[model samples]
Target chain A: MSALKRVQQWATFARVWHIYDASWQNPFKSAELLKKYLMGLHKPIYHPMNDCGDHVIVINSGDIALPGDEWKRRVYFHHTGYPGGATWTLAWELHSKDPTMVLRKAVYNSMDGNLQRRYTMERLHLFPDANVPTNLLKNVSNQIQQLKAKPKRLDHYSENQVKQFPKIFDYPKDYILK
Target chain B: MLLNMNMIVPLGILRNVLFQSKFPIRSMRIFPRLQLKEIREVQNEKELVIYGEIVPSERANILLKNTHPQACPLCASGLDVKHTDILIISQFVRSDGCMLPRRITGLCRTQQKRMSSLVTMAQKAGLMPNLNPANSKKDPKKRFQWKKFNKYFDESTIKS
Candidate 1:
């Protein structure tokens, strides 16, 4: 087959893929973004039954942010199929046990519970860290923008930049502003 | 006389007569008659040894072609083997979070293929970590240090 023909054939059958960075971003917002791609809502040929969803590769899931005290307040419940077997796990506890669970659960909960949901969920690949295999990385053509800007860490700023900021007033030598 | 009697009597009757003549009736009743082959000892022990080795080699050729039967651990434990089982069994994830090979997992070809796909699905679902630890720029062991901010200065300056 000709190169152009092969390329055209691949384009017709292939689904578009996107990479999402979940670091320092709200988990709920990331989940919503992931759901859009997983459902192929961005595509023109989306159908309810057809498995036409684009693949979403999520990286840095371990670093996903939760607003306020949701980490301690959120509770995940499970039962062991025995009497009095119900158990509850705090969000932080679950995140600590499985770094990816927080993001996975958020995305899973956001999706409609239907047969296609499972298939769509399957396409939403999540990595707890930034590392991704080369094969999957190749599929990612673009990165989805984070809803909130990542807060810059103090250590990330150079000494020059820190010193360059305009000073408003000098503090008294003896006064410690605790 | 015996040859003439053998010709006249039937084979079954001849054997009964021979057995009756050899042992007393009471002894015959107590012990069943033994076949000649059963009572006889082997004349050559070396011949038996040679036959034993030769027979096994012919049987081994047929048996060697079959794979050793090994049940999948999940299946043996009555657990429905899923992608999660693959991660648990392998223990260590690849730098890219790819699955360990079948040789390492001891899974059959079909199970290995199924597991590979499941791992991919798990990765997409945010259920598995995919980052290569070695390639990450951030120090994994860095501790979060607490810094006391001056209340006199605007809080926004320090927060950013």
Candidate 2:
């Protein structure tokens, strides 16, 4: 093929990739990997003080999973300051009442307090249902088939990965590896 | 002894043992000891209801912001509204108990003072009932006796 034809084909593939839902189960890992893969953070224009990353559209929020009793025990309290003003509601109750609110609140809380944080927040588009337009990537038959299977969801680790989690010991001696 | 001239009893008097106890029940005071009385008994209905009058949220918000009993005295910042801060304005009771300081309600000092004054004002205005008569304070011994009665009834029900 001529060099001009090859360049045109590559450009078409790039456009298709831009519209694809390269879905990942683990959002943290997905974001981190995509940051490097897409050269979002390494660009000469990259600034730590500013949020300059591309937008990430998250769908199927109802299918998102949490591993522990966080859904039930977590409580949010507020009051109107009148007779019987104070009230308590749980995370599960909030989720059931409004699923989109749950995800939005979670992501917003996860962000730092700054102008950049606001920018990061604006980039996140969350849909409680499968409402996103992924038609651009639909033409890529192989990619679509792979995405149909559950995206390998990433878990955000606060300290370390769960797989290498150290077992709790009542005594210091018990933690010694044989 | 009944026939003794010196031992004459009053014409209409009947000696009852129930009323002869060393600790006679004290009568409840009419004022200072604010107790919740029946609404029908209260002559003024206008003083009772604070809601349904469309009081602006800004007013409540302002009161909460400025004079909340739980706020800090030094700063306008939030502080805990302790049990001590809880003003129990009983209608007839002179002494109102305050709630203890707690971790929640981060009331600043100025707010607490403001709130305390507001509560006192509320009590004086008779807007808030000082106490409920049904929940009036009782002697611990009497409470224990009531518990005993409860236990007896519970046992009887079990037997049946």
Candidate 3:
């Protein structure tokens, strides 16, 4: 192979490490996106028989947000083969026990239930907070963008900025401000 | 004429009532209320004085001006305000984070309902923690059970 062709082949076949911020994001939605990368769906040479796949490091999994009342409404079911062993856990209850478990299960469940699923999950790394290990941090060369914009808090703005924002409606003349 | 000087009526409404009577509407005069003033009360040694001061609203000079006689101020401005926009939502809120009454806000019935809903969403999202209830948690990040996490609202979910 020519020098340029050899470098191109090495680049396409090499594993790429991607970092994703899970703070304030919906876990189910993030899982779909992460599953594609974990299964090497983005690679041009992706095939069912190919072993090539990318590694995804997700941080702030503890901060995943559920839509509306899903925290209490959604339930995870489990059974241990015995008739009385069946149990259901609320989303929040499960999250309270392990913050990273929710996101880990989300990405795991997003993929097909084939035998290779467990092997594919081995490449996924989840951290409850932003503190990723130095070894894992060094491998991330790409970042996946967050699905939603972080909402700004009113107290985060300077006093001047709030006062300078345009007024929409004025209070009545007789109104007293506390 | 049946005179009740204590009654403070608008000129247009007074004219409509007087048009059917012998009182000459042309002879009447109008003292318009101050558009921008703050009323304050002072207790003197022997008496009380209640007066208004010309106090302009902050940023009044550069506010988005609007004029649509048939529509409310918000509707006339044509602003598609969302729940995440705390700046516009704060205008319709009191110091205690309560929604101002319809009469005070001067918003149409539909807009009033929507604005109140937006206000609720903003509070739920913890965007305006400073104006929340005194007994409530001041830090949104420290809220109880399931609420401490950051959550957002979709404006479409509002019924209006």
Candidate 4:
């Protein structure tokens, strides 16, 4: 192959790294999107056993959102294989212990129940915060869109923005403001 | 003698009692001040604290035009209000992050309940940190443990 053509081939064949912001995203939904890239399902020559050169870097995994009270409601079950060794941990507790654990498990549970699942998970890199290493970050060429829009806090708005917003109703003339 | 009495010096106690009954309206105002009182450590007397309210002319001139006159303000506008809609939710909240009572908001029964719940949800999510109490940590990220993380609410999960 010509020198230019060889370089082009390498560029096309090299692994395409994708970065996804886990902030305010449901990890389960994100896992579905990441699964395609990890397994090369989106490629034309995709096979169940085939390996693809794709890396998904999920940042702010600690900020992944759970739908309503799920943090306290959802429980993770574990056992040591000894009699009376069973233990259950709430989602919040687990997240507090390891910020990335919730998203990691969510992504893991979302995949197929087979040995290949473990291998596929290796391609997924989860970060608790937005501190991805420079080497891995440089390779990222694509960003996966979050399913849900990130929520903005009231305090985030500027004072002028809040003040300029239309008033809902004027307080009664007789009523006193606190 | 009558002409001389017209310019006569009025006694402090007699003049006070004379104007007190005639001009009671002067003592009471249209918009009464807050009735909050404080007892200072230095003095035993209770001090009446008068707070200033925003003048009508100085208020936000830009008000949402309510199209529906019959229906409630929220019901009139067919907006799918979400908890994340802090702009809309903040309108129903007080300076201290408390939801305004239905009487003041003038929302219908359903809207009032829904908005209050949405307000609660937003507050718990630390979305209205600025409107919180004086002792609050203004930054949501500075909250304890899991609370410091970014979390969103499912409106459907809210019980009416």
Top candidate (TM-score)? 3
Pairs of colliding residues, candidate 4: A154-B127
Which of candidates 1 and 4 reaches a greater TM-score?
4
* RMSD, every candidate, angstroms: 30.2, 26.6, 9.9, 8.7
lDDT of 4 by residue, B1-160 (tens): 1112113233453345546675543433333344222222222234322333334533436766679889887888777889888998988887788889888888999989999999988887777888887888888778875677666777887677
- Alpha-carbon deviation at A8 in model 3, angstroms: 1.0
Best by DockQ: 4
Error of 4 at B5 (Å): 33
Question: After aligning candidate 3 to the native by TM-score, how far in Å is the CA of B7 from where it should be?
Answer: 16
Docking quality band of candidate 2, CAPRI definitions: incorrect
Give one digit per residue, the lDDT tens place, for model 2 in A42-158. 344556653345544556555443322345556767799998999888765665676555556665665556666665666555666667666522443322121223311112232
What is the DockQ ranking, best to worst? 4, 3, 2, 1
Q: Model 4's lDDT to the true fold?
A: 0.76
Among these predictions, the greatest lDDT belongs to: 3
lDDT of 1 by residue, B1-160 (tens): 1433112334456457767775654522211232111111123432311111111111122222223345643333343434333233223235455566555455556555655665553343234332334454333223121111000111122211
Error of 1 at A139 (Å): 1.5
Model 3, A1-178: lDDT tens digits are 8999999999998999999999889999999999989999988899989978899999999988777768778899999999799999988888989999989999989999998899999999999999999999999999999988667778888988888888777666545454
Candidate 2 per-residue lDDT, tens place, B110-153, comes to 44344445444332222333322347333211332112110100
Least well predicted 10-residue stretch by lDDT in candidate 2 chain B: B148-157
Between the candidate structures 3 and 4, which one is better when assessed by lDDT? 3
- Clash pairs, candidate 1, are A124-B124, A124-B125, A125-B123, A125-B124, A126-B123, A126-B124, A126-B126, A131-B131, A131-B132
